[model samples]
Target: MRETPDTPSPRSRRAFLRDAAAAGLVTAVPGLAVSACSGAERTEAAAASPHPVTPAASSPAAGLTSNGYGRTAADYARTGLTPGTVQQWEDGFRTAAANDDPDVFEWWYSDFTGDDGTVVSFTLSTRLDDGFVPEPGEDRRRPRSAVIVTDPDGTSHGGTQEYDWSEFSAARDRCDVRLGPFTFTGDLKTYRMRGHSGDVGVDLTLTGLVPPFRPGTGVIYFGDTDDHFGWLCVVPSGTVTGSVTVNGKERSFTGHGYHDRNWGNRPFPYSVEHWRWGRGSVGPYSVIGADLHLREQYGSATVPVFLVDDTKAGKRLVGAYDTRTVTATESAPVPYDDPAYPRDYYSKVHWTYHDGADRADFTFTDTGQRIVSRHYLTSPTDAQQKALDRLGIDEIWYTRYATDNDLTLALATTHAAGSGTGTLEAAQFGLADAPPRTGSSAS
Candidate 1:
């Protein structure tokens, strides 16, 4: 298992910040908008097949936090929580001990896409060692935030903002979280969000089109220590109506939107190689899914779960054994090298899915790359870096891609086909940046 990226104690707090500042670690702003020569996006067709792991015979029971752990919805049901939002974003854990663990992390996430091909995403998140919980004796650790607003043309303006613990707050009763200049508030039915960094400012509102879908106790404990992590999909699919302003020009946009909550004890890469997740809208049908490949020791807990709103069956949640992911080919790999990197990484060309008898396909091509060498630069302290080094990791790659859909639903007596459009991505972690290379790494 990968090591947690956190500072264990507050004893050397001042020296920690000084070293981070010295290595340009504490700053969160992204670099200038120049295209950093991305690799190609086409070529060798990979044979298609379902993920190697077979489906599980049984699934965990779904319910409220009776055992102090929230569960995923076994089937679609209206969430009884207040409309605006659940306390998951702020108070996601079942125990005060987990909440106070600096190793734990939480973030409110949403992605907005304009009809004109502009994509904007913002996340207000932080590791919990310091004072994330505001209480008489709580630790007062600040949080870090990141925002990226990229247009179809590749023009972008956005970066990260590190906030002092005093500037972060989340309502105990609703989905109101303030991280310095960024604020996200509203019930799950509707939410207003605002954030400004560098030369970019994003002001958008998400209105629900589909009711919230919570999987059976969303939390999962995969390690020997049983540290748990969970996700809540407040707005599985929604409508985005707002504007993204870059420089002084503002562009209004309208499209489908997605908002969700992610909180856990370890970064995903620690256990998962990567995950393919996306939400698409076609008429009244809202489609979404998540396929995961667990890395090494964490393979035992891998599962695939997807939610689809069908006019005939309403909305139902399905498990991995109930679904299949087949890759017809892989696009050119967006090259990077870190001499100490581990694992063999490759691009996914056109990925197809079959949910039991229903089916859909999406084709994605590399559009842009976000190179945040921050993770590899130095993780807060020499000790943290050394720990990461033992894991054979350094840099991470998040390459954005546009998606085209081809689908054949089994809803009818016979499989029926349809088409749609959206976005998808590929993530590479714990690898060193290599000299520019492209194409498949196949022999």
Candidate 2:
């Protein structure tokens, strides 16, 4: 059994902010600090799988305050809350939060997989900070965008760019955002996105096939503090018709796509230890799953959220938030190249959701196609690097994998089983101390 680390006392918010500023952790754009490096390519081989351990069932501890964290079905029933409803304004720009504090951050994300095996993903983000100390006529709240395109032949092309704030604008009443030459606009039913990075450009239209979904109130509060994280799947499953231009050559195609929005008031390292998020379309069902592990200060809780939409029947089969009903097991550990912590990370994960007679199982296995791998703290100054060491923030690694998915669903008298391709992401903010490495490791 994996041992749970001891819970640490909560850090003062003011002190955290001080350290963050000292380390130059704040930036004009979110997710751009990473140092991009590709992992070694390897083929899959059969290995012995570890025994799965079931998570202990626990009721909400006293004084726990949250909308969707560590709550059971009965708890939600008392609050008269069902799955979730789409609010037009929820998909709009989070102007209030973005302007409230420098620590708050927001971003829009979308991706499409063509029928011919090409994949395109992109993000538009608001600033995470005004500036370390602004100079005259300097606006650090500039908007930024990134794009990644992987052709069917396995060639990848993409990059990131930051734009002046004057070139950025967003509507508060709907899903309309413009950053330089990039534009992402949509209602609940349909969306249009366009962006360019380096030699690649994408213009796509996505029509929704699954209704929008939120686990509960769409927000997870940390204890009694005002700090929280929010997420909404605007386009769970959609059809995409678009053209991708690469190296002065343009090609049009039809494909499937997914989009979602995320916003939070606190730095992710301070709240989240790690998470596994993924979505897929199998047979007649569209499924999305996330397993979030909170930091020790937040009771080290594991929150599992899942949604299964029956597109053929035009109804949702399950919208689960309770950790007791939804569970995840990680296996098939593989060592990655982290000198500070020579530990193995899981390359295979299985998720299961069951309530009474209804049950669903989804498994994702990495096929060795690592599209992204980077260290979050890129090119820190000498003083900033020292501050990071003081805070025990060693290596923050983010990796994305192209995966093969196997899904089985049995709801009442309906049954479905299928396999497909999808995307899975793993992020590590911190790790326990490990012995010094005597040799190199492979991913």
Candidate 3:
């Protein structure tokens, strides 16, 4: 499923290309500036509008500490944030009003060689997942495009290419990236990169590729199409392929396997979902897990999950965990024309995860982020508007300081429980921060 915003949306050609150029490693854009209002009340206006419908018989509540938030839909409307798409379902997969706010999801990994933060390489993947269920019966082709921009003063460089299956399992992805200062290369099948931070300047490389399976996979993803009760699965397995480069050195990788965030529910007290790090002789594992509980001002509880993986085992294990910090870097006041909110904006978050063998620490400082504030009409009675809310950061900046980095990882389902019951494996080592993938399915 693909979604293209026909209503002239904001697009930054330079930001897109700069992100692509930092394919092989970490690319840090300037942190986005946002409004820091004192005594800022959490209102529906501050968040995406809710969908309208006969309220669910009961709403699941997520139990977590309040960040001193006290406001409802009414109070928020008083603020500038306008309500757009809102839909409340009487009986739906997940309760609450479905808000169709424009959102962008970007993941970045910066791998350092032997502590001391020396020599870095990173890969940044960005996507826009505007919320809307294809207008019920509307199967219109969603317009999508990725543009690469160069920093003329900084000497930007990167590559562009797509892959086609040469044989059933034998796949080949083509990419052309500029390696060093003012150098452009084309059709480079295999390459590797290594470099210092300031000495290197990177840009974007656009592709004409269609998203597989889920739409809005980039931004706010809901339950999976196959199983309405569970969370959405974006990169299921062996579907995404790209290479990373930094400074003058680079590396070519299959980026095999898949990883996803599950937004499932749990009981009270255990309200926050979590993902942590673990190790085994088989492969380094990161758990994409979370804790679910009830919130102070909600009917039921909500489950917020994240993706966690480490290369101690053969496959970087992933599961959910508790403890998350979503810092809204670019919180603009409501009303699109508001001068308080900046246009080229984004968000950043800090989270922690643990699993016996290792403790995972992640500080995601994502820049160049934006979300669509719109309304959703699930049904005639279910009309609602989701206000502009902060989305995921462009970069998943993280650090895995383990008790035993040599423990190796073993794959388990990204949302599975128990031990010795996983199938994924990690193939890259030394660069343990990079997410590992496998051919097996972990649902």
Cα lDDT of candidate 1 equals: 0.51
| Ranking 2 against 3 by TM-score, winner | 2
Model 2, runs deviating above 4 Å: 1-64, 67-83, 128-141, 337-341, 381-391, 433-443
For candidate 3, the clash count comes to 122
Model 1 C-alpha lDDT per residue in residues 331-402, reported as the tens digit of each score: 456443444443434434444556456565544443344323233233335544554465555654454445
Report per-prediction Cα RMSD to one decimal.
15.2, 13.6, 21.8
Q: Output the better candidate (2/3) by lDDT.
A: 2
The residue ranges of model 1 lying beyond 4 angstroms of the native Cα positions read: 1-100, 128-141, 195-198, 249-251, 280-286, 310-345, 349-381, 412-415, 431-443
Backbone clash count, each prediction separately: 29, 0, 122
Arranged by TM-score, best first: 2, 1, 3
Q: What's the distance in Å from true for residue 260, model 3?
A: 6.2
Per-prediction TM-score = 0.64, 0.76, 0.26
Leading candidate by lDDT: 2
Tens digit per residue, CA lDDT, model 2, 248-279? 88999698888888876555766677788877
Report the Cα lDDT for candidate 2.
0.66
Q: For model 3, how does the per-residue alpha-carbon lDDT over 174-284 read when each residue is reduced to its tens digit?
A: 111222222212121112222223434332221211111111111111221110122223222221233334455544333223322222111111111112222211123
